[model samples]
Target: MNDEVAQQVVPRTRYHALFVVAILTGSFLLFLVQPMVARMALPRLGGAPAVWNSAMLVYQALLLGGYAYAHWLGRVPVRMQAGIHLAVLAVAAMWLPIGLTAMELPADAEPAFWVPWLFGASIGPLFFAISAQAPLLQRWYSVASGGRDPYALYAASNVGSFGGLIAYPLLVEPGLALRGQSLLWTIGYALVFLLVAGCATLLPRRVGGEPHVAHHSPAPGAGRVLHWVLLAFVPSGLMLATTTFLTTDIVAMPMLWVLPLGLYLLSFSFAFREGEALPAALTRIAPVLLLMFGSVLIAGDQQLAYVNALIGLLLLFLVAVALHSCMYRLRPAPDRLTGFYLAMSVGGALGGVFSGLIAPIVFDWTYEYPLLILAAGMLMPQAFLFDPIARLWRGSAQLLRIKTLAATLAIAVPLYLGLFNPGGLLGPMHEQVAFVGIAAIGLFSVGRRIPYLVALAGGLFLFGGYRAIETSLSGDRTRSYFGVYTVTDMPRERRLAHGTTLHGIQLKGARSRLPTTYYVPGSGVGQAMLAAPQLYGPAARIGVVGLGTGTLACYARPGQHWRFYEIDPAMVDLSRDSGKFSFLRQCAPQAEIIVGDARLRLAQTLPASLDLLALDAFSSDAVPMHLMTTEAFTTYARVLAPDGLLLVHISNRFLALSPVVAAAAARGGWHAARLVYTPSAPEKRDEAAISDWIALSRDPATLARLTGGQWQPLTPQRSFTPWTDDYASVVPVMRALNPSLADD
Candidate 1:
């Protein structure tokens, strides 16, 4: 009897190990493909960012489909479940070595529609097969192990998810190119298939076509299921909202994209498994943090970027873990695991759609970030930390609720006064002091929902809500496919800003017709446009990629047909309409403006047409990746006359794009020169901000003319990999971004 028991124990242990390994490998590979395929598509899609959001929608839909498929397989026998999954894997293999198919988006294509369609058609089958592995394998383990707890294995799956997310940025991307990453993922997929097959063999056989039965739990009610969905929804939406906030100019690279998502995945592990004590404690204090940081973050442009970034990340981690914990706490029985996960997937998909697709269209700013943060606060499981607090809640609960509302009013009134009472008794310092006091009062009601929300609403209103509400009331903000833009009216200037970066600044009245900001006479594009009549004759056909207030429109002359390629329709409206900036209306009323992605639109224009084409498009933070690639330069080359100049605005806060342009120019067989325009205090009139422009041309005479006076010959960073449609790495650019860091 001892020997029989020992043999049986060995197989059980082996099969459980196989199940664990299968779940981990499948989840890891599943997340690994998401960013990999996105990186591959970056150059083709440009840095519009809506592309990534749209891609996320496709991923969520496939995940829901996979989870539903897994739920359906529950009715089948264990062996047949194994057979069907294996066959599905075999079929999905046809689309392996996963990469996007070669299909260029048409000029008029709606990215919100096309991006999802493209990704769905390309990787949908493979993702569907792999995504089903976690919940499906966990169910198989329950049957095989005589109904052992399968929930703990979910922790393993998320650990694998965290691993995959971190590894893509830290290991796989740095060590290997896209081709290598794709190949490695293929190997990992094969390993997952074998492990899953091994796990299938451990199931106890009931013999010839018999129904394999186990302890089935009772069905969950609609309310209980709805609770699961709502719990999952807040965290998922907040994760995407945080990503959208962080990536815009804070750190506009692919690696930073993983931070919010990586934390979100790791939250599941802690929320589900043995490390419950730590998450529970943090969750209790999460409300306080949300009240303090949530409003200030949404207010934005505080100038303490690093501190805000850290606080923002912390806020996301706390809420995500806490909300996910609610999910783990309310999880249904093992027999109902598939249904539970299906609800989770549904919630996740809905969240993605709201943040990624709907919010950008509906709101003029990232209003979703604050709204989701507030939702996270409301949804997170709450309880008083101390017994005294609990007694207070029970005894004076009704009084406390009313008092909480009054307390919120009191806090809000003082905060409102402080923000608006410029100079004398209350200033910025007084505002900070009021916030400190609010923070202290907020800490007392750590787990009480009403008091906490009062504090939260007050804090939000105090920190940035006052300003945001004021801006909203004025109705000067415009939200677009790219990001939110604030058209701030100043005494001297009317500025167009995307986030913290000023896109264009037009001086009021008569000064508006003058080219200002980065387009002043001393700037490279400024100098090039000044010399256009002599360089390409009086009938100069000029092209500009980015039209910010149509500042360059001031340079247009008679018989000069100027064309502007602007990606955002909002920009076109603001820059051209006589009611807005008036640079285009007053100076170049006849200028033809094309509204679409500059790269795609430029390709559709007449070939060999322009004297000078200035590439100045902005996606708020960084230059559109698609615009600086070799292919993009080739498109520009095709549209220019033999000696026509190509002027690229390379000035950026977070990126060193001079090298990128130099490499692109080198690859396209053109001489290049860079003019780094740094304005002195005296030369700062008419909004002449700092600028950097790269001039590239195939003709020696044109390059000589552009470089003769102030421009210096551009040098390519030989060690830096040139950006192509297939590959571009931001690490080197990041390192060279600062003088101090470059030496290290």
Candidate 2:
């Protein structure tokens, strides 16, 4: 290996520079392609958060498969390895020039079961091959550069991932149409294929004429593999837990999932950085921070979005750095890099499954979060500064045991009160006091493991588990595809809620159907439904999308036909059952109720039948991406009578939905006006606030009549960017929030 030739193959050389460049480019291209394709599917799949969750599951499964295949090929000779992988890549390209199939989702199928089926049928194989790129290419970089630190390349990989994530919301989505985005991804994939081939050429044919196949060895033992699984499991579940806590209780908005996942990936960059390592001291402080912050996390709804997000992310980073640093310490030598990654891949996949799948089924609530926090506490490595104090604590001597027992009693008394005594022990001020006491005790037990374990148990019992149990015991709770709906029964009425925001409310036994809370008679949907008879004559056909305690059912009049398209079967059952609010039974008992996704069901309706359509289908904070697409508006226009009205509900604490509706109305040649509802009082029974609703129609008369009554123009939001099917932005809406926006 002469100087000039070595330079050609080495880190700073022309060839080596291109090698690094190609790997980073391929990773960027690969990650960018994921969101692009998933966004394309939104128009067809409808904007159920389940759609994105399903797509991510498919990607995780394929990624694990790819890593496993890479591990297997490490046993093959270098040339044969390249040959096989190239052949695999070629086969994957057969399905490319990517676009979703023309197949429609089944009208009757459950979204939980069908979304995975849909994504798997569409692009599983291509994603699997592309997902294998990072690990395999990193190994090749190690081999090509004679085992130089290739770990820095991983930082480049996540940087690309973050770039892709940011680009979807900022650039690719809002800028290009779906068709254009697909073609661009296809071109990038082609470039990646070429790059992989070029990278293969740089691999050493045989090191000193010895086979590269003989360099690696068998898989790790079960104990070592389980250690990897536990380390990976904590961060992954905690990420999802953070998402649930933030969105469900703290804030509900579109695209909030991105931040937690973004931070999770960023932590990996720090964990694996080779040259600049996380110090041992930082690792030691992390557990204490975890114990401290973990209690604060479950300290009831912070409602402080930025503050809570900052604290949650900081806690995740500290724990992730501590745990992943452990994984880094356990990392095998460069020769076993591929096998080491295979174990990690297994752990990553398992963690996702536990958090996404098993947790949802096994626990009625989001219990996986607290459980994972405990797991992180168990796995975190700790050491004590005072050896004598630690020995006295662990020993079973009579006086020492009595002192230990007294310390245990001191922690338990307050913890029991905090956890079991409702507002007594874990009250507002007591939470912090209990946490400080626990942290002080945890300091004494650091290196010994059991003290930290007790502290973690004490913290969870005081913070997370008790509240979770409280929310669980009250039958006021309801879980559906939309999210957790808690039915709050008041003195005069009962309210249907999605998180803290009330969807609909009905008086104890009212005769006339009056719009309650955000659905004031003067609001957008209210005005449209109120004017339905005048616009379409006495026999006007009305279609209400989404059934929330059947509140809209009360607007029906004699000789007027009405229908409701509801997605959740649970909602349908609740609305009709005698125990719940009987708006349908009391108001429009004869109205037809079609079950399934409203957009899909709407496609089956007779053309020009509906004189008025009101879209009120919001599942928690999830903006059904499919409903706001240009094609969806077209469907609404097709079924509606020429002079009909369309009313969309946009009252959300998180997303500014009016701009998206305005964008659709503009694209579809319909006139649109928004009505912002502000109630006279903040706590005056949720049924009294004005619902932020937008009304649109092709007929000037319909729009005029609907706006004739107390309708006010919603101040046009300059910061609100129109969200399209091809691309959407949540930043504008999130930024528009005033500091004083109080959580209900």
Candidate 3:
């Protein structure tokens, strides 16, 4: 009898392992292709950070479709479903070695629409086919394993997803080019086909068989499905918002993009596993973390930006795990598994749409980050840390009302002082005092839902949210598909900032015409601009790629033909027409401004039209990878005269980019010199920031002329590959060699 039971269990265990491997492989490929295809599209679409978000939306939408397909396939027999899925996998293989299609973006294309269209065209069929594998395979596992619970297999799926996301930047990207990455993914897809087929063979022989588990439970109601969706929504949206916040406001590191998403996928593993201790404990503590960390996240602490980024990530992970665990607790029997996942996919797609697509357009700042944090607070499971607190809440209706009132009043005192009377009555530490009071109230309100939500909302409003609201009300903040920009008027200067990076600042009075920030006379770009006439004679044609406050226009001499290429139309309005910065209107009023991507516009210009080409385009603090590629430099070379100086603003807070420029210069047969410009104390007081610029030219004499004094020879890394349209990764250049250089 014991041997009979052992023999039965052995086959079931083997079947389980086969299904797990198949789902894991499919999920890994599904996530691996996301970043791969996005990287492939960087050159054609431009590297605005929003491009990643748009790609995410396309993936999420496809995931929804895939889940829905799996749900609909349930009406068919198990054998038919397996056969159809295998056929779909074979059909999707035709798009193997995935890449962008031959579709060219229109000159006046809108990125919001164009990006999704391009990505969907490139990888839609393949992603759709593989996305359905997780749910479909789980269903097959239940049938094959004699009505065993299948939801635990989801943990394996998400573990594979996390691995794939982490591997792209750390392994595949640095080691392989685009073509190689595509081939590797194709091989993985082929492996998935075989593993899936092996799992299919384990299915029951009866064509119309249903799992015995299906007879034990009824179908879920409409409200239950909606509950699953709400549980899924907050975490999905919060993940994207956290990614944007970390990359935009915190340190912009090379692999920072994967951290939030990797954590999000890992949360599913923690949430869905058979073990309950970790998920339950995390859910219990989630409310307190939300109130404490969510408040501090919105407060914008640049001094502790890295610490804050970690906290934000921790907060996101906890929230996602808690909410996902709620979905797990509410999960129906094995019969409704596909429908459950379909609802989750719907919520995830809606969340991505709201945060990735809608928030950037509707709000000036990252309002979605706070809003989603609040939503997480509302959705996440809450339980008292102690039995006494639970008893106090469960005593009586009247007692509960009194306790809630006291909690609200306790939270309100600090909120009121922090909002209207900061430092007046509570002294200099008033903000700290308010934080403690709100945190205390939030702690006690846990497990009491309504009061805890009130505390969370209060925490959000007190910590930097009011300031964001003020900025929005004043019309000083502008949102574009690229990023958020804010203009501030100081005592003696007006400043322009893209996200947290200062773009340009203009002093009032006589110094208004003088260049400031990175374009000061002592900077490398400044030296190149000052020597424009001497290099190419009086009628030098100058083309500046980025038109930030048009500060470089001050270097334009009377006969110099200056044309500015700016991507954002809102930026043109601010620097040129909005009467904010007077650099363009005062200095180069007649300088033509062309509104479009600099690379695409530069590609259309006649050959040898410009004597000096300055490349300074930035999306927030990130240098668009496309502009730094060898192909982009080829276009710059085509548009510039033989002796033309190509000035690249390599000033960055997180990345050491001189090596990249040096590699490109070596490949293109150009002499390059780098200038590390540190201004004098007096210059610092006058808004002159430290800047790094690299000057390159095919003519050695021209580069020599530009780098005469402070410039030094480029130190090219022998192992660092030159970034080309075919492949580029920031891993080699992210040494943080000059962390003090302010963004240009």
The model with the greatest TM-score is 3
Best by lDDT: 3
Q: What value of lDDT does candidate 1 attain over all alpha carbons?
A: 0.79
- Name model 1 segments beyond 4 Å from true: 1-13, 42-50, 102-107, 169-177, 207-215, 247-255, 385-391, 394-430, 736-744
lDDT of 2 by residue, 139-211 (tens): 7787678767665676677777777777777777666777787787788778878888888888766543235
> What TM-score would you give candidate 1 relative to the actual structure?
0.92
Model 3, range 534-562, lDDT digits (tens) per residue? 99999999999988888999998999999
Q: Using TM-score as the measure, name the better of candidate 1 and candidate 3.
A: 3
Tell me the spans in candidate 3 whose CA falls farther than 4 Å from its real position.
1-10, 207-216, 736-744
Which parts of model 2 have CA positions greater than 4 angstroms off?
1-19, 103-118, 149-152, 208-219, 275-282, 302-305, 385-409, 419-432, 507-514, 537-539, 680-685, 712-724, 727-744
Give all candidates' CA lDDT scores: 0.79, 0.72, 0.85
Q: After superposition, how far is residue 727 of candidate 3 from its true place, in Å?
A: 2.1
Give the lDDT of residue 596 in candidate 2.
69
Residue 391, model 1: Cα distance from true site in angstroms: 4.4
TM-score of each: 0.92, 0.88, 0.95
What alpha-carbon RMSD in Å does predicted model 3 have with respect to the real structure?
3.0
Per-candidate clashes come to 0, 10, 0
